[model samples]
Target chain A: DVKVTQSSRYLVKRTGEKVFLECVQDMDHENMFWYRQDPGLGLRLIYFSYDVKMKEKGDIPEGYSVSREKKERFSLILESASTNQTSMYLCASSQGTGSYGYTFGSGTRLTVV
Target chain B: EDQVTQSPEALRLQEGESSSLNCSYTVSGLRGLFWYRQDPGKGPEFLFTLYSAGEEKEKERLKATLTKKESFLHITAPKPEDSATYLCAVRGGYSSASKIIFGSGTRLSIRP
Candidate 1:
């Protein structure tokens, strides 16, 4: 089946540490997105990539960045992890301009302390 | 600003109960509306997409209907396995990238 795979299901990080979350998609989609879901806040987009090596900031990209080195892999990076940055991170990919629905990965729940 | 809003934050029902979940949106030139089901500790799974007013779609016991300003997901004879957080999202023409806006979601619980 076509799928988006996240490298980790759960993670624990220390404050000020640099963190890396990896995602890979089996489908050759052109668009990839990173979102953090929080209670009462819903899913807030951090960044998205429309093509390889091309990345754009989403609404909440202050403490995060992204790298799309290959057609199937997109990575999210936290330059300096903070306690408040802890949340469930989701990776998603779409075929075109994102007018259609997206196939999402199982998600990574990161806890920062 | 463009936004999507879901009501009742949560709902509880007995098995075989039928109900509907609401998603209200205020967006410019709506492109599409989407419904997803999310289990605890898992990612959101795509369920349905409604593109225009009067459009409807169904799968098993779940049916979705859309209007100009809102959409409804109607559940018929729900089961315990159907319990999950239902999320609604919308894409708009305000941007070239077709950015999507998501709602807070409505958590549903079914008692057998």
Candidate 2:
């Protein structure tokens, strides 16, 4: 089955530590997205990459960055993790156009102390 | 800005009870409306996709219908297995890499 895989299911990091969250898609889709889910904010987009090496900021991209060095892998980076950044991070992928539904990863729950 | 809103943040029902969940949205252009079911600690599973008003889709005891302003997911004789958080999302006008907007979600519980 087509799937989006996130490397970590749960993670804990220090306040100033740098964290890396990895995602890989086997569907060969062109668009990959990163979203953070909070209590009342719903799912807020952090960043997304439409093509290899091409990244764009989403609605809530302040504390996060992304890298897509290859077609299948997209990485989310926290330059300096903070307590406020702790949340359930989701990864999703879809074809560039005409794709109906997005295939989402199981999600990574992160905690910063 | 495109926005999707779901009503009744939480709902409780007895097994075999029937009800409907609402998803209201406003967007520049409506490409598609989607319904997903998310069990705790798991990713959202795609359930149905409606492309236009007056469209309907069904699977088992779940049926979804769409209108220009909103969409409804109706459950007929729901079972305990159907308890989960139902999420609604919309894909619309193209400006960003991804145009999909999601609602906060409705958590449903069914008692035996």
Candidate 3:
């Protein structure tokens, strides 16, 4: 079985504060993704990394960035958190090909006050 | 742009009853369609992946079928434990990588 673990399950941060959400996958998948899920918006992609040091912006990438220094770890960074940034953040990983669906982490609910 | 829409934002069913959830999508070229079950406050758990129109996959009481423009997930004699948010996603087009677009999901509730 594949395991995807997030660094924090819940987090609270003040406005303008820097925040980091970490994710690690044991499957060594080549594709890693960061998504923010809202009530009506579903899961909107924030950023994705296909390989180490390679990143691409998804549909909604404003105020957020990602890092993939290693194959097993992907990190989502909020340069300066705002109240609007509060959301349920999910991390997922998939193989290079388009055959398999993503394996998701438990998700982190971030509250920016 | 690829878009996915799940019908019946919410559903309520009695235990032992059966029903189907619909996922409609429009994309340039379909690569795959996926079904996932998400529990409250948790990430989605993958259920099925349908690649072609006539493909079908099943696990236990849940079965998924695909067509050219949509997919259906049918639950047979559902139990309370089967209650969850069912999500659909599609992967398609040439966007440097395989990017998946997800639907808002249909929340299912089973009454005991």
TM-score of each: 0.97, 0.96, 0.97
Question: By TM-score, highest first, what's the ranking?
Answer: 3, 1, 2
Least well predicted 10-residue stretch by lDDT in candidate 3 chain B: B92-101
Q: Which stretches of candidate 1 lie over 4 Å from their true place?
A: B94-96
- DockQ, per model, reads 0.72, 0.60, 0.70
- Using DockQ as the measure, the top candidate is 1
Q: What tens-digit string does per-residue lDDT give for candidate 3 at B1-103?
A: 7899999899999999999999999997888999999999999999999999999999999999999999999999999999999999999886548788899
- lDDT ranking from best candidate downward: 3, 1, 2
lDDT of 3 at B3: 90
Model 3 lDDT, residue A47, Cα: 96
What is candidate 2's lDDT per residue for B10-112, written digit by digit as tens?
Answer: 9999999999999999987787899999888777888999999999999999999999999999999999999999999999886544468899999999999
Q: Rate the local accuracy (lDDT) of all candidates.
A: 0.94, 0.92, 0.94
TM-score of chain B of each: 0.97, 0.96, 0.97
